[model samples]
Structure formats: structure tokens, C-alpha cells
Target: MQPMSRKTQYFTDSVIRRMTRISLDCGAINLAQGFPDFDPPQAMLDRLAEVSHLGPHQYPITMGAPNFRQALARKCGRFMGLELDPDTNIVVTIGSTEAMVDTIFALTNPGDKIVMFSPYFENYHAQALFADCQPIYVPLVPPKFNFDANVLEEAFKQHPKAILICNPSNPSGKVFTYEELKLIADLCIKYDVYAIMDEVYEHIVYAPHKHTYMATLPGMWERTVSCSSLSKTYSITGWRLGYAIAPKPIMDKIKQYHDFNTVGAPAPLMEAAVVGLEMPDSYYEEFGAHYAHMKQLFTDGLRRIGIPFTDPQGAYFVLANIGPYMKKGQTDVEFCEEMARKVGVACVPGTSFFMEDVRDIVRVHFAKKDETLLEALNRLEDIKAKMA
Candidate 1:
């Protein structure tokens, strides 16, 4: 038999998803993957029930369902300070995963260089490789997760076709500040590079840390492909509703990519999620507050258990340092698996998210219920002894 494609031959299964399976096998509380154990908004649930019976069960428009895109345009425009045209500027995707990959395929060619921050979400590197692109990784130096402007400019100077930014970044939870984003915008403009933004945690920012839209910066709208999803914001990761917003010329290509890829997001789900997209400002306020509460609950529990973790400025994930808990010569992968089996908690090994050799950190999420987080923490209280 012929061998598999070289593009994927070297790829291992997703470490995050693998940890979730390990958690299941061990009957541990699963914080490995970032999905919520709680319900989505009751409004979206109610709408979904109605849509099941009312029936738009078949595929909607190739670009997206019209009402869904319109709601997204209004909601995103209100926050982004740009009047988005749903018809010409948006292409709904299966999820931000699809939105991101589709944008990459649409914007870049094989062998092109793509700049991305180190310790990125695992998917970005895979997506670049799938497009046959070279990734230029700029480290978001750990502890504070800040980048030096000089280092970034040097990456930009490589003249990459596009740069991917995940504000309120996963694994690190670093929210790029306005000044930092402005510097990035200036560099992109100077280098004539495109910016692909993954702002999935846009609404989950903690106080004193703001989420700035890359497209909102001056001279950036024309070159920015803003990708986000209803998954994180609406707590409907399974529904897989996401979209990309770009200029008409760029969006035309993205729509083609999305159309051929997923053929549009789920129709009934889109219909249901429009209710979420149209939710008022108060809904977002309450949403942020709920996540803030969860973050505090989980992080405070970690502290009391004598576990050291990075307090996130935005997003629901926390990277806990487990170096002290590991056995001699134990890899993070082994430690995480052992953690699930013996410690009754699960997390993704930090090795999955970095270009550099980082193995002492594990990424866990606080998207679960208060009771669930409490139980995980309770189980973790004796982790030192259990792992030993």
C-alpha cells in the first residue's frame, strides 16, 4: 500500500484531545480539553429546539445563513467599530478551526513564510504546515508572556505572507495590549503582510486587560483577516459555528475555501446561534462575569492546594507548573497521564503548545462548573503524594 501524505505523516494525534481520552479512561475530572461541562445559554438551547421542528435542516447559503451573518455583523461591528457587510465581509465556517485554516489557504501559498508567536495554540502550526507554509515563531517570553518589539520586527522583516495573532492567547493567557497591537500593525504595514487574528476569547477578558481587535487599528482593516467563533462566547463548542471577516476581495476567496471545505456551518445550529449573536450587551457582561468567577474559583483553589499557576489576564485556561511533582526523568506526557490515573485530574502537556523545549507546564481550563472545579482541586490537593 502507498504511504500516507508526507504533510500529515509526521503529525501525531492532538495532545489536548488525547489527554481528554486519558481522563475518560481513568474516570478523572476532565480539564484537558477546553469545553464547558455546563449548558449553553438557555436562549440558544430554546432556539435550537424550535429549529429542529421548524426545519432548515438542509444546508443554508454557502457563505452562511443570512440571518446569522447579519446578527454576527451587527454584534462584531458594534464592538470592532467597523460597519461590516454580512454579504461581502463574512464567511461562516465549521468553527474557528476551519475559519483559521480556510483563511490561511486563501491568503498564503505553498512555501510561504507565516509568522506566529511561540507557545501558540497547537492548531496554528499544524494549519501552516497543512498549507505547506513555513512558520516563523516569535517567542512570547514566558512568566509575563511579553514580546520584545525588536524581535517581532525581525520576524516581520522575514517578509512572511501573513502573521497569526491569538489575543488572550491559549496556554499562556496573554492579552496583547493596545500599544503592542499598534506596534504589530505598524510592522505589518511596513512589511506589507497580512494579519490573521484568532480572537476566540474576545469576550472573556479579565479586568484591567482589554481585548483589542487587530482590524480596529488604523491602516489594518485592509490587510486583516479576523477569525472568531460562537463556540467560546456561547459555550457551544460542539455546535461548531465560526466565521471570518475580511475585505470583499479576500472574503471572496475565503468563501470559496469554506464552501469547498465544510460547505457552510450547520444550518440549524446557525439559526439557533443567531439568538446568541443578537444577545444584548448585558448578556456579554454577564458572560464575562461568569467566566471571571470561574477563573477566580479555580485559581484560588490551585493556590490553596499549593499548586503554582500563571494567573490569566483573559481566557479560561491556566498553565500550572508541575515540575516539582514529576518523578525523575519523567516527561510531561507521562506526568499528565499519571496525573489522570492517580491524581484524578487531567491536563494537556505544555510541550504541545511551544516551539521551544518546555515540558514542566500543563494547560488546564476553568470552563467547568463551580462544583466540578472544586472537586478537581480537591482531588489535586494530594497530588504531590499521589504522583510520588
Candidate 2:
């Protein structure tokens, strides 16, 4: 009989996915997880249908199939304005989840310190622990989620090995502005720290707000590891397609880690998704407009229901202030559970996304279809009556 590793003791199972299962059990409309209940581009589906019979099902090159990496490098260059050598730069992964862990493992040794923002995607916190490292948490002041540059500099002085930046961040959906990115980029360079970026929402940014690649920053390409996925962009969350783009030195190690951990992302799936990677600029433009429309529809619904929430600049989740509804002794978790079972809508308790005590908010995603949003809102309208 033996005990488990101490590293895992710092975290538990994903609260987001857990709530999703609970939502399923309660027969609630599951807005708890961020997967879209819509179809991906027809081009990808058609490609998949064709590729299925062609059969590359076994495995591809360790880092990625040649064509896939070429497509990715071309896409990255076209979008980010940087020509990347696919052979040395990209490590295709089983979703950004793997890309992140791979980067963490490849770059940091146990006991190293890594900088992370508060109210981050919950997985980052767990991954820190899993990587046997400590995170220096810098708070992104709420209501706007802006950070104090001075405060961030203090965190960097802690001599952390790297900073994990989730631009167009999750939960809060606060896209880091160019100035903020410059602040971070400056701090990283000054502190001689690496920047590990999660840019999965690169294409999901709302207009008037834009996503800037950290790797494209002056003198930062070599020090920044850009990790992202096709899940959110292409609506193929189930495909588990993700990757890390770094300079050769870093990517060499990431590739070694990824190769042993994963033979490679599913071969046939990569072949099909390359079609999405090569999509026209108009395709991405329409994508942003579609999400903008959904965001407007859902947020407008919340306002009509008289619920207070922070507006998202990018990504699809809204962090609603449900403080008024937290009855005498009920915690956000209890309120969320009751909302799912009785109110018939499911959401993740906001506490899950924070490093500090944050229990007045719950996260809901607007990546669903219009009909689904309408139904969720209609059910939410009876919140007071149902909870009372």
C-alpha cells in the first residue's frame, strides 16, 4: 500500500468538467462547460469524411505530420506576421491542455517559480502543482481585470522561471490590451523570464479588442512559447487538437516530451483540420461576427433578467455577479447546484476560477446556439421564485 504523489495533493479534479456531469445528471441545460453545441465548418467535416477511408489512423510524425505543420506555420505567419520554420517550431498536441503541460514540463524544473494571474483557467493552477512548482499570483483587478504594472514587477522580482499568460483569458474573458502585453513583455525581458502564452481564443476576440501574439513582440520570439488549440476556433473540442509554437531550442525539448507522452495527435484528424488551418481571412471574420452576435444575445438576455455580469472582451464566458442570490448560508457552489437542479440551468461556481476567496460570481458560456441561449435565459428568469 502506498500514498499518491504529494504534487497532486494541491489540486483536485476539474470543477468545470465535474459540474458538466452534474448538469447532465440533473437534466439541466449544460452551460457549465464551454464546448459549442454547434457544428464545425463543413470543409473540415467533408475532409474528415474523405480522409477516413484514406487511412492515416495509426500515427504521424512525433511533432506533427509534415503537411499539418506546414499549414500551421503558414497560418501563423499569415496571421502573426512571423515566418516560422515548421520543422523546428511547432509541437502539435492533444489539445492546448497537453500543449501547456508539455511546455511547463519542458521548461521548468521542480521547485521553480512561475508567474500566473488570479482568476485564471483552473487548469493552470493544477498544472503548476503537477509540475512541482509554485505560482506567484498577480491579481488582475476586477470590474475591468486590469493589472497594476508595479504589482506585476513585484511578482517578477520573485525570480520566477516563467510567466503563464492566458490572453483573451478564460472565465473573465478579458483580452489583454497591447499596452498590457507590452508591460508584461517588458517585465519578462527585464526579469529574464520566459513567457508561456495560451492564445486559444486568438480568433475569438471581439471587435474594438484585438489579440496580439506575444511571440511577435520585439525581441520576444525566442523567449515566448505560444500555446493554442483548434478547439474553440473550429468548434471541434472533441478532436483534442492543440500545439505549442516556440523557437527551436524550446520546441526541441517540447517535442521530446510530447513524443513520449503522445505518439502524436490523431493522424486522420490532423489531416482534416489542416483544411481549417488554411481557411480564408473571411472565414475567420465571419467566425468573430458569429460569436459577437451570440455574446450580444446572451448578455442582453441577462440584462433583461436583471442579472449583473461583467462584459467579456473576448472568448464566450461571462462572469455574473450572483451575490444578491446567495441566500443566508448558501455558498456559490450550493447556489449553482440548486440553479442546475431547480432553476434548470447549469453554470460553474466562480470560486473555481480564483486563487483568492471569490464566491459571488458564477461563469456561464454563450457559445451555444441562439435557441439554447433563449431557453437558458427563460429558465433563469424564474431564479427568485424557484430558489425562494
Candidate 3:
């Protein structure tokens, strides 16, 4: 066999994706993967159907499909309050997964340091490693899930080459406020470092909590690389379409890496996504409302059972604190495995999402049918009773 890459040995397969498979194997109600169970809007489906038969199914422009890029540019410009050049500033990739990977590869040299907030999307750490960049983790403290400004500033003072910021973050679902973004921007500017942002949940914020676009900050747009996916916005995770938006010069290099790496996202999917990218303001309003419904139903169930969970400001995850019910010897992972096998429900352990002490936490997904969530809640009640 060929020698394995040293990088591959450092990380395990994704715990969330692994739990999702176990959820399937055990025939459990799966709340492990963050994907939504609902179909995308009819407009996108209809457009896809129209394009499915139309020719032009060959390779798209390696950077992105022209129409798709134009639509994305217009949409982002309108929403983010920055003029984006369709041809030079955007490069569509397979997903935010690929976008981040390509960004790291294009920007970082071996031995360069990258600081990422912990409880980050698991892929970020792996990407940093694969690029031969050292990853420095700064933890987001619990309950409130807020970062101390001093700690974040200290991380920047290390003169790290880059920072990965996930606003409306994964796992914890803690959206960074405008002031928070400003603080981070100030540090990045002070250090003259790159800021790669994952804004996948940009549109899913609950009321009273807003999603701040990192690129909108003063003098930050030029140094910031913004990556997002149509998956969360359009509820089309399987479509595998995402993009990186940056200054034309940075995007020029990112596209070179992306071209050699994945070539481009699927042509047909890109065509279909134009509809989603062109959706009206009301589409977003309704999207927020839909997620709000799911969040309410899911959180309300947890509340009824006296289970404490971090109330998400955005994103689809709910990180429930199961500390009270954990038995004398059960680790969070073990408890989650038993929940799937015995209660017929599946959730990811919080420890999988973090690199620190989080034995009493397990993360669940609310992006399922009402009946599905109800069943998980019922099983959780049984868990509570048994532990009590």
C-alpha cells in the first residue's frame, strides 16, 4: 500500500456524520446530521426540473457558471451592502467544506498558525491540518457561549496567519453580534491577518438576534474571505453548491486552488440554484419563520422535560445540557449511543463538537418532522425518568 499521509492519521472521521450513520443502523429517529428533512422551495425544484433535460450538462466554467455567479453576486451585494464583481470575486465550490479547504491551502504556508474558536465546525481543524497550518483553538465558554474579548485578542496577538470565524456558529448555534464582529475585525486589522468566515447560517437567525456579515466591517472586506452555501439557505444540502467571496485578488488565487482541487460544483445544480439566489425578501422572511417553528417545537419539548439547552440565536442545532441525567459512569458519547439503541433516538454528543470538557452535553437537530421530534422527545422523557 502507498504510504498514508501523515495528516490523515491525526484526525478521526466526523463524529456527527458517524452518529448519523449509527442513527440509521439502529433504526432510530435521526437528529444527528444537521440537514433539513423538508424539500426546497417549489421554485428551485421547478427550475431544476426545467434544467435537468436542457443540454449544457457538460463541464461548467471551472470558476462557476456565469448565470449562477451573477445571481449570487447580485444577491450578496444587495444583502451584504458591498459591490461584488461576478466574474472576479466569486468562485463556486462543492460546498463550504471545499471552500474553506481551498482557502486554507491557497493562503497558508506550512508551519503558519491559524487561530479558530473551539466548538467550531469540525472540518475547519482538519482543513488547517491538511494545509500543514497549525491550528490554535480559543474556546467559547459555556451557557452563554460567548468569547472573552481578551482571550480573542490574545489569540490574534500570537501573530497567527489567519483566523476562521463561524458566525451563527455550528454546534453551539451562537451568532456573533455586530459588536463581536467589530472586535474580531479590529484584531484582524491590527495583526494584518486573514479572516475566513463561514456564514452558512446567515439567514436563519431567530428574532431579536441578527446575523452580521463579517465582510461588511470597515477595512475588513479586503482581508476577509466569506464562504457560504446554498444548502442552509435553500434547504438543499445534497446539491453540494457553495461559494467563497473575497477581494478579487484573493479570489483569483482561491479560484486557482479550487480549479485544481475540485474543478467546479455540478453544472445542473448551479443552474437550479440561481432560482434560490434570486429569491425575494419575503422568501427569507418565510425561511426564518419556518426555522422558528422547528426551533420552538424542538426547544419547547426540551423545556417540558426540564432539559437545559443553549437557546440558539441562529443555525439548526440545539446543544442540550444533559448533565443532570448523566449516570455515574456514562460518557456523553456512551449516553448518546445508548439513547439511539434503547430509546430509538439519535443525537450527537457535544464532546464531538468540542476539544474540551463537555461530558454532560449532547447536540440534537430540530430540522425534522413534528412527529419525528415528538418521538425523540418522548424517548428523552423516558431517559429522564430512568435517570431520575
Highest-lDDT candidate: 1
Residue-level lDDT of model 3, residues 1-388, one tens digit each, is 9987788888889888888888889998889888987889999999999999994598999999999999999999898999999998899999999999889988889999999988888788788998888888899987768888899888888889999989888988898988988988899999999999999999989989998888899989889999999989999999999999999889988988998999888999999889899999999999999899999998999899888888988899988887877789889888888778877888888877788877988888898778778888888887766554
Question: How far is 310's C-alpha from truth in model 3 (Å)?
Answer: 1.0
Instruction: Summarize candidate 1's per-residue lDDT along 87-123 as a digit string, tens digits.
Output: 9999899899999999999999999999999889999
Model 2 ranges with Cα > 4 A deviation: none
Better of 2 and 3 by lDDT: 2
Q: State the lDDT of candidate 2 residue by residue for 240-330, as single tens digits.
A: 9999999999999998889898879999999999999999999999999999999999999999999999999999999998888778888
* Candidate 1 lDDT for residue 324: 94
lDDT of 3 at 108: 86
Weakest lDDT window of 10 consecutive positions for candidate 3: 379-388
Worst 10 residues of 1 by lDDT: 3-12
How much does each candidate deviate from the true structure in C-alpha RMSD? 0.9, 0.9, 1.4
Q: Which sections of candidate 1 miss by over 4 Å?
A: none
